[model samples]
Target: MPPQPSRRTFLQLTGVSAASVALGVSAPASADATPARPIPDGAFALGVASGDPRPDGFVLWTRLAPTPLATDGHGGMPSADVPVQYEVAEDSGFRRVVRRGLAIATPDLAHAVHPEVRGLQPGREYFYRFRVGNQLSPTGRTKTLPATGDSFSFATASCQAWYHGYFPAHRDIARRTPDAVFFLGDYIYEYGINAGDNLWREGVTVGPEHAVEIETLEQYRLRYGLFKSDPDLQAAHAAAPWFLVWDDHEVQNNYGAANSLYGVPPELFVHRRAVAYRAYYENLPFALDSLPDGPDGRIYRRYDVGSLARVHLLDTRQYRDPLPVDEADRLSEQRTIMGAEQERWLYDGLRGSRTPWNLVAGGVVLTAITDDRTEQWDGYPANRRRVLEAMGDAGTAVMLTGDIHRHVASELKLDFADPASRTVGVELVCSSIGSNGDGVDTDQYAKDWLQHPYVKLYNARRGYVHTTLTRSELTAEFVTFPYIQADANAQPNVVARFRTPAVDPRLEAL
Candidate 1:
């Protein structure tokens, strides 16, 4: 694959001239100054979102999906390009307008718009909205990371299968309004809906459009539409910016690199992956640099949130070796989860990081759970050790992860078998937003897994983790809901809290 384009290169290719787009303009012209068609009634049905925040600005996103569930995957948009106008303001009422621009919603991209807005003040809140003729999108709140600050906060969540339960966790996350949300994969499941599996939500069922597995580009786009149509999930996206990475479920379960779980050939799997990846990019608030190149994209990038923290978002599913079938294969020294390039990048970043808290966010768990080697860091022990050793008493290192559908707190040791091995860092695994139905507080798997001394706490429920990072310490809360399969009104509460002191990589219950 060729190297991805830089931000300026992408803008030039897309006809989005950064110089022409001005700030502090109350009203901007249409994309080409052409009279757009009459605005459709609910063009912003999927709602508005922002992501990939920088110190100076962030990306704003919206899709013209008047009918999100349309079978053709066009989202009820015209076959031609539609000009959409957007504005950024310092307040909710749009009185203090700052940045304004226009971006075309093309039919080829499912009428999606990603405006890479810049030239804004750092460490301050800004509100943004989109417009087309008389239609206006919901106002969304976003902020740039402080250039230098003493603190920051974020939430980690993943694995939200719409058919399993309601999105009460997302609703609560929206209410908390964290600075950013790290969505660690399983954004949308690839399985076809089954009535037998719809035992949760009473009187709720998947529509005909979602009754088949997603494979083609159109199908993947429609699947994303189905998930994004959820009111609770839409609210979460609108409330705060998100940083995303994908896992197997985004294409198919257990897919690694070019491998698929159903024994499909590598050549065929690549096509499916390309389509899924394209749809994923079109639906999120990702910067142009993250645009897909065939079956590959560059997602492993560093986000420096001032002097307080540095978040290294990783892409584990795209470059990892296939699942090991036997113990010898699992223990092979050549096995890698982050590929060679990403591994080198991560090591260099960790070694040269200047922030007080260094956060490595990925899609799967890092701590060893048991002898069973399946799909997490346990399957690639050699590479995991390399990463853990690179920290080497640097500033505080923390691993934020999702997947496994359970909340986990554990100590990251250089060697799991060696009890004397030093604790290099800590790993906090957030539970699913709504997967595996309404889960119990504890399960047989949790009982068997807690036998490991490094494993600290386990809660099997539907929720996310909220974290607060400061110069001195990092605090994390495992927030959970009583039930979500049947109760859309379920509320979230903190079930456990842990604190890790700076320079001391140990989890202490609070």
Candidate 2:
């Protein structure tokens, strides 16, 4: 990589003419030619991505990480702000540039930039790239949602641990080229590397640098950098815009609100959560509205995919009560997974939505299970009932979930124990990207889950759920990979498939 430039040198070299002018930035000269100085070798090593698609446009993101795994967590960038230029073109070749802008990659935010691009045509595919002097970031393709439409395709994935295995599932997701990806959390694991309790993959171990649990801001930032360094993950991000929600592993296992699983005091856990939340915002393609306010960030929101589907992206971890330890506690009416405010918001959205399909995207499973899985909706019975009742006879609802590390297709019922209760919707739980290493086809755990008739399918594997939503019906394919621990060339296979007709909410095997 080229030597780090001085603050003055960077400003002088990047703050030049036409591009700055287009973005309304006052600069010295026209930037029609390359910089007089040498460009850095890996300035855009982390790659480019876009997300949160609107009818007009979406957010474009990139970080200047020439040295991605630096210990200081600055991505090997200088302390000064770097002016990065971006362009949106109708073609990948940039021959028909439409929008050009400049954004400052600030050091305080770990040299990341999120430019809220707007005024583009709806339902149109656009190619975007970032530039710093003569250096160019990887080109990324993103599309804006249409104002009205009949069909849309999206994939749901979650629980990608860097130490667990290779990200063959992400590569497969890129190849599928979905319109959007719903990443339902555990985006990063918080456990210390090589802890011996969890051995990641067979014969493969985590590096020494990550051998300690991440607690501080720098540590968390570095952890995210390490995961983002994976080329497969980068390819997926580059392929389609992502809608993300973080589960427990983003901070610590089974952490609820300010409560820690290790019995850490609430006061201290809040500080840790603050750091994790800030780092999460800095790394992902979230808009400024999702920026962290101390330990809290507004992640629960809604997206309209034309007239086809209404996606409610929820945050179930930030304001929920801790997991119940006993049956009495689990059945408590006061116990909540989605806090009161979020619950109201979701209920109101479901009651008033006019879209053909109502899709609720969440971090944990919503379907009723036979086991006492208090960490999931099984523990928050009252809240789950409220949601089901809110959906009432709407019958158009579907829940997309992750975090169980297994693929499941289940019926959402007012009561799982009683077959006479009304069925409100269907829940599709996607398997992990690569969390539990190479999973088996059928395990004792899978058979154990089959005790509940609501669970139509259960598979222990590493992959994602691909779904196609149309005006007539919704089809879901449980895409899985045989191995991920060592097989980079692993291909995804459809282990099972199901479909739900427009007015019928039952998940029937296809």
Candidate 3:
């Protein structure tokens, strides 16, 4: 066995050490840092991805997985770390190279690399790719936002389940190729994959061993490997930079800082959650600074699209309290959806922004789902009030959300009980990419959401929401499709479109 590491070194290795501590340990320099000759076949199976875009640069991602489905969860890589080379160019043809760098693919991280490339032109398109020895990965396209601009566009998506059918939404989003994609959680479900689950993809069978719920690090890594292997999902990742966050399904069904809904002890579940988070960090192209230490990690962040809009991403799951069970608990001022520090970060970040448009993006629907207020913002009214106050303190605001598997466009109010409550912002609840089968055009059960006068449209279907922002106004199209189960190349139809002026809190039908 390898020598046991010291407590300080272990803490540093797991990223639990002090923020000032340098995590890297230097080794002797070599002429060629990475392997240049021996071939690792199909190392880029899960495909390349890029996200967390900025004015100067963005993050690039890839994994060396010659055998992606290896039960060991290391993606069939060498026990030693591998150095991967990356290239960024102004053109897809690679005639004008811009910036280049090397990122280490470590075994502990499932052989993945999240390289944050900087010092590029702002608001311009760039092409990037990865190379391990002579094997080059599939080329991906990404762009940086302008420091100040007149217009910007982006797509919002969430809740894609591998068991549910196919990703026509991702396929469509790739075709649209927005400036950036806000992926608001549930990227991969923790549920097991069975051979009978998706017969749509004939000859595709998951081992019976995978039919159990994923709770271990290996299970979570294998789950992501199966999900990321989708070609449609891969195309969407390659299409544009994605600003990503997570919801409950990323870990378990309805878990928080408290004991799980499944009744697992918090002491035990935290270990499972830690490994789940580590797997999540390794799979996606999020910033490395948000790395998890034990059960603690930071996913709440802010992004800007020039001077036109500022997007505030929240972590509604990590610090959220358990689902309220009684009236007092439901209305308790002590209750919180975004825990203290995250709440403070969110409020200050939103209130202090100078951009004309400020957006709050999160996993759960910001508005009330119905009379019940358990898992969503409604469960923590005081927290919602404070967030609304922040939104009102800032100028015109829009809250983008996912996870209810339905689309909703409504006006957010500080007081849901008072009919005269002033509308402070606009809320858009996007449907899942493909979580609940092919879905439908309308559902009678979803009508309760439309009971509120402020609520404009509610639809139960499978697709995403596309929005475009100008200096004066923002237009959103509620795109849905009737069939993804029957056909993989299903087309999208915009059932509802709304336009709201930068100064208006109302969602006007288009």
Candidate 4:
């Protein structure tokens, strides 16, 4: 067998201290000038992170602190700029360095820094590292999509509640090693845990010490810091760069426009939403194009992963009007979840897409959801129908959504009026990473909507979906784990596999 990676390599990979630290150390600074602060000294404390890769470039990210500490209420760090340097190598041994840069973590953005690096060769795996002074961060790995390729496979995942369980499924996701990971909303819920909450049999401790609803930027930062501390989550981020979108829990559960059922005033809700969005921007490895405008910001954008795909990342919450809850006779056409401009953008991209596939990254469950009480696509039939019509017009489209803590797959038909008719495209919804399972009734709820026969499989298992893509076909495998509270050695098996070949509408079981 080949020799194992050296302790130095392991330290580099795990973001542990490296030999370079000794060489970089300097004498203690004087108290009159800049006061010295303790640097992070362990592995993946703030969690490894990566995101949004173009054919020639990608974004790498991380926050300071061996712990997930953030700025105070004023968003000002009490310390000086943290010198964060990053190196990306084509070889795991880091034999050949492709890119290197320095990022300053400031208190204004909660010390979170995202360095957007470009000029990387397409369709390659690269390892990266962040270093401050002599202390090293966990080594993270990411890959670019194949440019002008026949096919590439990827997966969609979302909504992880730290207290709900474990992230065993994430281990399996790392093994599959897709070019990119698509995260659709609810990355971290702001909800307080309470005993006997039916949504979860038991609650896990999350957020800051105060268990109150997050409102200010400090509260939002605290919430994010709390989640970043999870080892499993940190490992997953280290494995690959993620394409992300937000859902309700990131701000408030079931919040739309200025309306919310949680009894928070609309103005207050908007205020909190702004804080949440800023914190999100601070935490993720996003392009500068994602910077917030004022407090209320837009999260919709598009990215291309080589020539393999063009992804449309949308913000369904910020622009949408209040979800309509009218009787059949009082239907209004003005209300929309995607709003007008965003919908137009999506349709135009779909119609104009030159790539082999068009992937939509958005929050909330968008497929065959039948609850009128919930504000999913199913609740707004007119909008859902319009999207389906557009999908039919847009050739070779595949949608991936997350919100529901379960796995579901189906071939979308232009007109669900006839289930056996032409298959317009396909959709795969992955389950939560460590979030609580939607009670035992999840299966029944899924099956009750069989009238929309486009649905192929709906499972309540807590796991993830893996997809492989080529120019001619796209194959997705739903990998389900036994339980979250399991060991890292645990592997999720291929619970179900489905494929959609190019030019063919029907999805076939593999």
Highest lDDT: give the candidate number: 1
Of models 1 and 4, which has the larger lDDT? 1
Q: Write the per-residue lDDT of candidate 3 for residues 1-510, one digit (tens) a residue.
A: 113334454354444333211111111245255674464699999999999999999988897888888887767787766767889999999999998777766666777788888899899899999988878999999989888978888889999887777888999999998898989989988876766554343346677756789988888888898889889999999999999999989899878764578988776777767778878988998777777765667889888878888889999998888888898988899899899999899888887889888878998877765648478887888898888888888867889999989888998887766769877878888998878877877798666887788889888898899999888988999999877665568888999999988875689998
Which ranking of candidates, highest lDDT first?
1, 2, 3, 4
Better of 2 and 3 by TM-score: 3
Better lDDT candidate (1, 3): 1
Q: What is candidate 4's CA lDDT for residue 373?
A: 41
Candidate 4 lDDT over 160-191, as tens digits, reads: 87556666666667766777788888877776
Query: Model 3: residues >4 Å from true position, as ranges?
Result: 1-33, 36-39, 195-203
TM-score between candidate 2 and the true structure: 0.91
Alpha carbon deviation, residue 371, candidate 4 (Å): 5.8
* Pairs in steric clash, model 3: none
Better of 3 and 4 by lDDT: 3
Better of 2 and 4 by lDDT: 2
TM-score of 1: 0.93
CA shift of 74, model 2, Å:
1.1
Query: What local lDDT score does residue 99 receive in model 3, on the 0 to 100 scale?
Result: 80
Name the lDDT of candidate 2: 0.82
Worst 10 residues of 4 by lDDT: 18-27
